[model samples]
Target: MTPHSIVPRYRCWSKKLKTTLYTYPENWRAFKAQIAAQYSGARLKVASSAPAFTFGQTNRTPAFLNNFPLGKVPAFQGDDGFCLFESNAIAHYLSNEALRGSSPQAQSQVIQWVSFADSEIIPPASAWVFPTLGIMQFNKQATEQAKEEIKKVLSVLNQHLNTRTFLVGERVSLADISVACSMLWLYKQVLEPSFRQPYPNVTRWFQTCVNQPQFKAVLGEVKLCEKMAQFDPKKFADMQPKKDTATKKDTPPKKEKAAKEASKPQEKKEKKKEEKKAAPAVEEMDECEAALASEPKAKDPFAHLPKSPFVLDEFKRKYSNEDTLTVAVPHFWEHFDKEGYSIWYGEYKYPEELTMTFMSCNLIMGMFQRLDKLRKNGFASVILFGGNNDSSISGIWVFRGQDLAFTLSDDWQIDYESYSWRKLDPDTEETKTMVKEYFAWEGEFKHVGKPFNTGKCFK
Candidate 1:
């Protein structure tokens, strides 16, 4: 059944108890629900504050499971026995006619901006923010790409807000509350002045939204990020639980080991001390000998390929700093080698799972990070096409050998299995067009029939 069908009408209950919200204390979804309740003059209570529910353990009980089958956080159960899940739906039910749009068109616009916040803003914001919060593992390449994508999203919002104060109407609405709450972590944790300077309109609108009386009540004294936070390896390591190091059943008891140590003769202790002085020299020799024997023995894949005049680093520098069509594309063709290297087109195997543009872009960034070893011998421009819930991923790859680079090394094989690859003939017009379009980061992809939302470069 559809989600809306299960959400009973707000007018169905004449007498309503304080809505019980089940979520973590700092959950953004729950924050959205709280703001909506404040705006609509509705009573809401935290489930953890009530006697019946504990934060983690209570949510997993059979009784709680019967009420909310999914058992996801930010769930709601009204005093009238009505239930709802999904933050957006709960927020909508809590809102009154004024917060929700007054007219049909306005309501549709409100929904559009809410969808935009979910599909465009949240993915990249989470990628950049979660690592700093120690929620996800950090990777340098993925973080950089996420920052760039966030800039684009903010630019769009900046332009739109330049003409209008609120996202949909003259005053605060559910749209403003939803979008601002989605961006709460980003503004408070990562969007420092220097990084956000370009989008002054977005910054102003965000500040205005948070400063509203309703918003201030939910998110008190919002603090803008003074400096962008970076990933801390120590924090990431500390979050992981320590492994159990107790001795196994096959190991000897600690008491037997202690008794053996006490049994050593006093005279032999002095002799052992003398031997210990000489033992360091012997151990140093053994370490050196072991180092030579145990050194990495894997052969370099690029060793077999003949070296060409094309330097990947130089081309990348030109591609990045100069005009792609005029300078970079020309340089790439001039150094193109038909025999020593090959070009391939790669497509994601499961387009159905790609629901957001920023997330699709992250998938590409993650793949590039896993393929770091290929930086010296390979280059690629993978692009995310279309909008939210209807998108595809494809890229053009240049490898040092005729075969795919992933086949050359196991290090590059992590994410390659998720994509289908086809070797393109460099001599064909189609191949040349694909290379120029993908590398230049512009051109109508007629085959996909979707605009390029974002792209990532490997190398």
Candidate 2:
């Protein structure tokens, strides 16, 4: 007799349903497996889908449109017209208690982390991986920008999972499920063991999530793709003209000396000429092709930073009011924490909106950057909030090392109009305990739901 696999009680929900999974063959397999084994034997069915609509897929068939007017694939139609898109959402609907938990809080926590997976994890990972894999054009500027952003996001996740085994309310939740599935292809196709060295916690968490019977069922018999294309610039050199070779005898002594001296000045002149000539071409191209197609050079900005003891005090007084998000935020970032301590940059949001939205986002980004300074005693974060009242605006700014509580004091909050800033309970023993844990980690930490939001940073 064939032994029947016993479904774990937590995942034994969503039973007796003719759940048609409208998805690409490559995408739907894993979801099908989880349902077949745990739920009431969901039949695996593939829908003819086009590419780049989502995940390199184009048009979703009319059948999908009838089921889900949005036309998103990996979509599921329950027997009761419960139509859903987004793989994680579909997986949750089909899993035990929708793969969140039986409890109300558990469910909320699941949703929270799942949102993080979609909003935080996927953005950077996909941005870096897709282009590198040749699934998208390997634009140097775009890829580097994506990699840097992804690294920062990954670091945040890494710090969060430092001690915790699972995200949200322990065990498995939709959060893990979603991120795991989204990352499935990258790990199999490109994120080789060597590449995973710094991200041990993420690797471990990913492996554990995929090891679930449901995950195995959905992602059956997949082969890892070849190493992803290196986003290095040397690879793109072929797109440019080769330098002319010079014979030894043709080189003159005076010419060589003059050439050496003139090379620096002449190159600058040539570069200006090239820029003028290339301006039109640049305007025509939507993507950055040859823009700085070289490895990023590390500069020690912190080296020459002014060590003036009055910088912080002056900054605090200069822009004490954050009520109106202004250019002051960037001004503060450009001025604060001198003495080679930290660096700041900008992060443009997708589907760009108004200035206020970017301002709110920038403030949060600054707060997170400040957290990094506390860890290393290197720098602080200062972001001015901007954008229109309805849109998301932001700045990715940093200041060299400073105390977190001191920099984000009540005065600063009032000035920044950071209505969302919440102080950790200074008197509470639990707060003290967690603070100890966070400081112990040397600043790389996140406190889950209670994580502070500066309304400017990317926490």
Candidate 3:
């Protein structure tokens, strides 16, 4: 008897079992897995909502760690204990002959496009997309470079797809799937009508691929970006976990209740008696008052420094609301305070450790956040430089004092240690130019020898 006829029960059981995918919903990689399954005619179940499969939290569990040591998403496991991780591998495994490519040459081409998607497309695509999605800190130079890189990529794809319907062959293959998924974020988040106008062929091919039955089933109705997104600080702040400030059990009652008790004649007399007993000890300060007294006082570190007529905030407002090169920079030099405040050049000590442009921007953002106490006393334009996996952080700091404003407060101490600082002589032509360039977030950074990426303002 044939194996199918001899083992009907086993064959039926095997067909009934489905592959389980462990991944977060809305992930582009997960879309690949879903699309592959649809094309392959395989039963696939999402394990995202399973009770034991909470993202980040559950993924770190021992059980999950046993399956995926790296703890990355888009993992897969077949019914027979066959397991796989990495979105590409899982998608390739789940695909049929047509999707994987029918011939050896076709398969090799598919692999070529997949690698191209990862290397040529993803880095720049991510730099542009993640900021718009509020997933990463935005850098202007980085974003612009990414835009240029994307334009080049789209130009290549546009030329290739001029007559052909798909990437590798006439039929939809893994190459199409891989490249489409890579472009998904850009199309959905940053590629608005005008920005995508240059690549009509690419746009047509992308829309066609996404509209196919398998792609549609997995991606649903794909919404193209309406407007190019700008980074919003509030959105970034909202993503961070809020600190818990619950009151302690040992904390005293509210001041209103204490005042109410003191208002009572009987309680007033009792309080006076207690105070008399403790009079010998210098009258004890109220616990709250004592706590408040113990807190570090904010003093103007520039009190001893000379005062100038320049108003930093007024200039900052003009700089922000008007054109930088035309209005703000001119206004800055016209009213700069040399003796009252000092300009300093600050550079990150460990530029070698800096990887991922956005994360490096975050390091600057975190510094600014921690330096909130110095907002009134300091103004800075810290810019991130270079591309992904290779970058530097440097900025011009204008402080209320001759020394670093961070030195005046313990609260600002957290991030300043990472940087090496040098005071700039404000009277020099070079210092004037540096202040103008850094403040306006433009001009060549000759000292760093890297293109400016993005900048944060500490105001």
Candidate 4:
């Protein structure tokens, strides 16, 4: 029999299996597993609060650590004594075959998207959203980079979901659950309407999933971000451990109080000195993190350049919200400022080294993420022009300066060297035709010998 038709070894692929979940209240990670249980009709009793499970105290206990070696939350304990750690694992175990995927190929695709959520989505989502929640420090550079990374990921997802409702198999699989939960914080805290306007597909899919009865059972009445959250110094400071202000109230005589005050100034000075000495060791855990919790000072590389009449942000909006060929392309030429800005053609030098189409796309995505800082002053349309093992990477890049903008900062230098770059003359009709083709992603370029596989826009 084929994998899809094959019967399971066990007669009972028990959807309603009894289990207990250990985690803190309102954890997005735990929500997936709980929501999976809701889908599968699994009996999952969550131990989120005191008398059931205390987060720091209970997780550190020997009993808890034995089941979850890492002492991680959302740990599952089955009625049959089977235990599972990691939110994804628990969610998968709790999911019915339909949610996990019925066939082998379907199952693999489910895992692929789950891995995407963990690797591609969660890291950047955490970096950007945690600081806003006062859960972590915020660094402007890191947060900006994280925003770019998330946008690229969303762009990929947006295109994938453009033609469908769900991530895989046209059903609400673990992939959708995992990815949505991973992005919960971003949606709730930072992905405001203005910010998320570009990725309409992602937003639609996310809203559809969350509004489902099963999902709402776990994550009740989801709210989209209206205002983008900023890192609050006071909020972060409040999260810090409060000092032991509760002191002994032993009644001392008036004379004793007078004597203590007389010596209090000297004692306070010594204590302050000790605090000054110890503060750096504790506070300087991560330089980037400290900056994230507080404002960091850095000069913009594009600050010294003369202001161009062409507004990059306005063009980005046009390209994202309106038709590229009809509106954005026409707008670009009308406000063309060749002296202040330059268009460049970049092609990957090592085509033979490229293998999978996904990997090639990732290489483009990675380059785009690294060039996050460039988003403010640049735009690019990087495309992969083949399938499977045979593919090539090429892109059209627009930057604020006449020279290569990568040389302006150390941060932008990472991926530019891997590609061969040649400045395109804006005045030439050849350049104008190329811009229209690349910007719209529709042209018969006899130069590149492969069909267009996939493309990513960097704005």
Question: Each prediction's Cα lDDT score?
Answer: 0.74, 0.46, 0.72, 0.76
Candidate 2 achieves a global lDDT of 0.46
Clashing pairs in 3: 141-453
lDDT of 3 by residue, 1-459 (tens): 321122101111124467899875567877887887777777899886548365655666788879887555778888898889888898888787788888999999998888778767876886677655544445565567689889989999999999887888667788988999989978987899998998899998888888887788888888898998777766544333334443544446686567567779988788898667545322212111222223345454555666678897677667655666788778877887777778899999999998866457547755764555465567778888888778888888888867788877655687888899999997898988898788767887788898776442222
lDDT (C-alpha) at residue 395 in model 3 = 87
Q: In model 4, how large is the Cα lDDT of residue 245? A: 36
What global local distance difference test value does model 4 have? 0.76
- Model number with the top TM-score: 1
Model 1 spans > 4 angstroms off: 1-15, 49-52, 248-459
Candidate 2 residue lDDT tens string, 73-106: 5566666677776666566656655455668887
Q: Which ten residues in a row have the lowest lDDT in candidate 4?
A: 2-11
| Tens digits of per-residue lDDT for model 1, 1-459 | 421122112222223577888875557777888988887777888764336554445665788879886455689988888999888999998888877888999999989988888767876776688668654456455567789889998999999999877788777788988999989889978999998999988887888888777777888888898999877767545433334444545457786577557766765887788576544322211111222222344466778778877787677667755777888889988888878888999999999999866567657765765555466578888888877799888889998889988988755676899999999998898988898898866897777788786543233
List ranges where model 4 is wrong by over 4 Å.
1-16, 244-459
List runs of model 3 lying over 4 Å from the truth: 1-17, 245-252, 256-459
Backbone clashes in candidate 3 total: 1
